[model samples]
Target: GRPLTFPPGYNAAQAFIDRHLDEGRGDRAAILSRHGTVSYAELAARVSRCAHALTGRGVRPGDRLLMVVQDRPAFFYLFWGAIKAGIVPVPVNTMLRSRDYAVLIEDSGCGALAYSAEFAGEIEPALAERRPALVLRLDPAEEAALFEHGPDRFDPVPAGAERDCFWLYSSGSTGRPKGAVHLQRDMAVTSELYGVRTLGATAEDRFFSAARLFFAYGLGNAMTFPLWVGGTAVLLDERPTPASTFATIARFRPTLFFGVPTLYASQLEALDQDRPDLSSLRACVSAGEALPGDLLHRWRERTGLEILDGIGSTEALHIFISNRPGRTRGGSSGTLVPGYRARILDDTGAELPPGQPGRLWIQGESIASRYWRNPERTAAAMVGGWLDTGDTYLRDEDGHFYYCGRSDDMLKVGGIWCSPFEIESALIEHPAVREAAVIGRADGDGLIKPEAWLVLTESAVGDDALEQDLRLHCKARLAPYKFPRRFHFVADLPKTATGKIQRFRLRLGAEPAG
Candidate 1:
């Protein structure tokens, strides 16, 4: 474990933006996007200019900048520039609808808003409800002129290690999103522990992520991980389908590729006909949702590269427990990261043994300081320097952590605790099943039983014969009472923006989108 230490006047921009140029990496590529390659020297100049642009627009220190921009070099420039000027930048998902934007606009109460023209239809309607003091569209010509008159020799803000630098809203897996306030030193902590120490990132490595920059996982994977070691960040601005991601990898030839479990499963399904040259990649990383053991083996068999599945959250900033390169287990989340502490606690808040399943709690320096303007939730979630991860987990005898499910997502069937993920993982192993989600539903006798919603493979049809085979498949792999009593062959499952299944929607009998 590395000690969290920083010198006086520890500004995040000085570390992530300006350090490369001071260390003789001025001409190196810092970002690669559709716009073009942005060198460290150019990035530094643009960031300084952006700071001047913000001040000229009446933005002051400690004010919030709400960014709904795309995954271009503009995103990097705006994010770093805000911190350099001592303003907080909050980036949210770009795939949301108009109503979503409206809620976020009211919740953020930011001084300025930056967005892309592609989402004008959604953002335009939201502005009628609430508008910030300043709004700018991220057009190339407009951005070029916005900071053209600013000086190039602007200095970084004098923010200390404990001062707030930025904010990231939660992905809203269960309810509304909460703004997580992060200090200036949090990103450096995760970059050192997970990126450099565990994954061996270096200046020569190129990084690409299928996840967008709004997520905590992606913020680390695409931005902090690469900039911490002066690596090049390869970015994509288009919607990430299997074809688009494969083309990006082939063109960029990145060393590390970050994706979620759903995207990996989809890519593996397309590999039979659309396999590309993946020789340049060292390995892939999976986070958002728990990675099934079957998907891991399938991906490795097809690509000859292992997928290091791990667990991270919006509160923890980045992965604190991950499966290392060659030390991966089939169905485990692997060991604790070097600078993190974990405990499994029962309902009474007492510690449980390694084999007993209970609530997961984590302690790390990179964890969020608190939620913005929500003291009640801050008190409930972050207490005594520990964060309740809101997940159910257990540690094995060999010191490996296993993910059960979200705390509320665990099922109680026949008066016994059961993890829906265990049943869903078993079902995903069947050849005809593409994806599966299990939830507790009442039966004819008013007793709880697992109900499986499945998305079948293209070659398979939902019929009585397939149903019988699925029954036998589950009965062989899971406990007798754990077998799903009802099956619904759905076109898709309800998932959050981060690709996590929304079991609560299924429990309410909401129709799955086609």
Candidate 2:
């Protein structure tokens, strides 16, 4: 985790893709998908062809190209192709609607859009609204024809480390998704610090992450981390259900598995019905949200594989604080990853003492320098080279950081600050509850009170008696004031594309039925 040194004019494509071939690993498998396995040589050739195809359609260095492809080998080709040709690739969530796509197209002012044919319904309307100069649709016939005509060996543009390489749109849990600009060196920094040092990834390992490549977590897990070490990545284009995930693991026998907490919960539930062979997995990672201690213990007991939960952000590019492979603490976010400096600061910008919860600020080379087209937000978030993470955390005496809720998510109840995470954790301990989300609901007097939304297990009945039992259960575990005043039985909680519970939507009076 020492600071990585890159020579002048570093292109991320060289480190992520071409380095494998340079090291005589051309015959090794680079990507595994439902279609088939692709070797390093084949992948590199396809990337070259993709770059050629883009350039043939008038793409140039520094041009912004928006990508809306699913999780497949094609995504890798398009992403690395843009980087190779010095075009800044902007990967977006494929689940977004036409309106969201329209906003992104306008915000990025992209010269071209590359999308798979499956997403034509969503992309066509956006394309009609904001007509970009070029659109590359990746239907099987069209894509194959383009690659067939394009050259298989083209020299990559020498984009300096400081040049923009890609942009990841925020999950928009709090507000509209903002484009976070990242440079060529940012990918290498995270791959070294978190992937190499923290996860202990190697060339022999096969990685499979349920998170898609568009999001920051999935991009690092399936793309950069494995590719950096000349390892193989398993890509799944379908929705990540427990059945599908376990089937992929059985088929691919991946050495590493990456998932969000919600997926882990569902997988555990699936294990109750049918336990798939998970012996191939050496480690499983959790992010996109905090992992509950109860769920972690259950997973370890069931699968015998430790879940390494970490905290990362879109702006930071990848995980800055994470639990290492053998040195994991069950509930905490482990220690700060190497190559990053973190500080828990008060509202006045003064550092807080250990064990005192405060705003978490981090400074690292991988952190994005700015938000695209939002100078005010960029200035507010990036203060003196440190990125304000907007999360509240406390460091214990053992140097491990514990997650409090987001600063905005924290509730002031009867002159006391309370974290919804604490209440949600306590609620999940109940046998009937499978998942829980707590949000502050305003009462008639305008005083904000804690309200709970519960997703019950299949055997649990949703009735007045069950509600009372859960209320009393919280009363036993949490402070009386901190306990949720109202409990709402829900079929499912609203979530962002990344699997984070959309508490803001719940707070906006999107009430769930009891």
What shift in Å separates residue 315 of candidate 2 from its native position after superposition?
0.7
- Over 400-471, each residue of candidate 1 has an lDDT whose tens digit, in order, gives 999999999999999999999999999999999999999988887878889899999999999889888999
Query: How does each model score on TM-score?
Result: 0.97, 0.97
> Against the true structure, what is every candidate's RMSD?
2.1, 1.9
Q: What is the C-alpha lDDT of each candidate?
A: 0.90, 0.89
Superposed by TM-score, candidate 2 places the C-alpha of residue 467 at a distance from the truth, in angstroms, of 2.4
Clash pairs, model 1 backbone: none
Among the numbered candidates, top TM-score falls to 1
Candidate 2 global CA lDDT score: 0.89
